[model samples]
Target: MIARRPEGADMEAKLFGSRLSPFVEKVARALQLKGIAFTLVPPKSPADFKRWNAQTRKMPVVEIDGRRVFDSTLILRRLDQLVPEPPLLDRDAGIAARQRFLEDWSDESLYWYAMALRWSDANAEATTTQVLGSIPAPAALRPVLRVVLRRQLRNQALAQGLARLPLETVVDELGRRFDELLVWLGDRPYFFADRPSVADLALFGQLNVLQSGPTPQAERLVAERPRLADYFLRVDAATAERRAEPGRGAARGVDFGTTARGA
Candidate 1:
């Protein structure tokens, strides 16, 4: 709540990830929350991404101080070290442990449900069309790329065991998770306190994907539960301004008059 200038403005971080990825969003939100300046750069093509990260072949990579770091969790850990003023983890060991546990569950388990919903036959065409439309692929090749990407994601979901379940089952599981979060959060602004934490960022990323992504299944499920819906909005509103100018550090007491919620 205090006004202070962010340090190392000259060393602006560079992030490698697509807009649609929740994992990428997780890192982006953390950077915003920490008031770090960073640029989000998406790959021009699959081969371009392969050249950047040949190992994991994943995104949300952060390049800082001439060093590149990959993985959302690891990127967050590094950010905490780089910008330690507003710490992401709590000082209390037990609270920190719980935050990490929830983050892991949200990232690994809850994520699959969103994937399953997006890639399922019910949502595939619409989701693929919407997502691929933003990619810088040729108009003629978009349809083919969409089919290939959708099929690959569907295969991943199937292998992960979520896509094998009935649609109702997936929805029910998602609902249960939402209910659990509502109960855990109670009336608090964040998962732990009035301010957001790493756990909040992790869950918010997935919730954003579910509620605002191409498929409306998760959003529809949230509609039946106002608390969950409001929580999503809270995170969305908090990050709205930062989403607009991700490369700029948020100034203390900065007023973003017209924020783009769910952008």
Candidate 2:
């Protein structure tokens, strides 16, 4: 692989979503790692959701030049197209296929597990507050938004089939998934590669949210696995540097190097 170089410094890319969302973080990390400088367009109200992405209303939407794109996977693909250096997908067909599967698993499977835990009874209040904190709603409306958001997300998690299970079961199953992730990761610095890829970014996004201050039960799950925790940090170091602009374009990343999972 060629030495990775940042490109599209002048690219006018704007990401729409709350950084707290794992899906948003997935795309944000991809942009930073790709060396693409972009603005993060945080939602001004709940209305921005449908406004930015009328099709799904879910976020981490990317607007390049003028074309808007939603979904984390598609956003990463767009990044690769814009800056092909240090590809997010491998050149080898087999490896790329494995990476793609892992990426989907992280997004489609692990994501729900993380979400189920986040919206679980034990963590709902904390999750609600953390999410509402970023929404810029009026003070009086916070309580109303809190109830609506919590109910809506919990319903979605229930519909997905994981939130119905007991929190302990969710935590246990998530641990097993983490174990399999380590197995797939083996001794590589990043998942299936010496460099970061969509797979690593996807996994990082889920793990990032699980430990991002709202889910202590899930955080403890990661705390038990030193390798998985370290892997999270390595991926962060690789991708989160340039966009590390605190309240700016960069979404905050958990630095396990400083903050332990349970800390």
Candidate 3:
């Protein structure tokens, strides 16, 4: 069940994002897990300038205590400062470094792979039309919009270094990475530590995309990593529990505060 806002606490802050965006979902899940209060707002479109113009030209911009924070990593860091307990980073430097490396890889490399799969799937053309069509474009310019979207997909593939790789190669590499990550995680309850860390958040976000999308390899990977799937389920359950408690506004309704401003 979704948590209800406490009556006397501070009003929940706003988050601009889309349901399909894994990055946004990651931040939202973090907030939910931390018992932080927030309101969600969907971005107007992928190219909605009004939403992007306000901050880092990105979706998932978080407004807290009247300050806006952009980027998922920075937002997670800010949340850590607000609630240091149940830490997201390890105290050990070496381990933390490794976790950070994996986090970065998941965010960039894995995310691109997921995107590639998404764009090349059988439903690609229909999905693209639905998402892009929402933008208010001139009737006479609809054909131009289609052309622009195709080019954008091509550009995204090129940017991710997957444009030159054959589709089979892309699938193989993604499968290989998933296998390696599962083996690395082993029987641990979390990816990098005894509890969920930033790395887990990053991995879970990307993995959620793969599982929800029309990718066969992604589905296979999840099936192979039953423990990892359980970890995600636990995280979701924790969030739900935190949301279910009545009048637990101490942490729930507080702001990200000065630390979020880098002050």
lDDT against the true structure, per candidate, is 0.75, 0.80, 0.65
Writing each residue's lDDT as its tens digit, candidate 1 over 51-76 gives: 77777888878888788998889989
For model 2, residues 112-171, the per-residue Cα lDDT tens digits are: 998888898888998888788778798998889988999888899999998899989888
Native-referenced Cα lDDT, model 1 = 0.75
Which residue pairs come into collision in candidate 2? none
* Decoy 2 TM-score against native: 0.90
TM-score of each: 0.88, 0.90, 0.78
Off by over 4 Å in 1: 7-11, 240-263
Model 1, TM vs. native:
0.88
Query: For model 1, where is the 10-residue window of minimal lDDT?
Result: 251-260
Stretches of model 3 off by over 4 angstroms after superposition: 1-11, 47-50, 53-56, 121-123, 126-147, 239-241, 248-263
Provide the lDDT at 253 for model 1.
24
Model 1 clash tally, residue pairs: 0
Q: Highest TM-score, which number?
A: 2
Between candidates 1 and 3, the one scoring higher on TM-score is 1
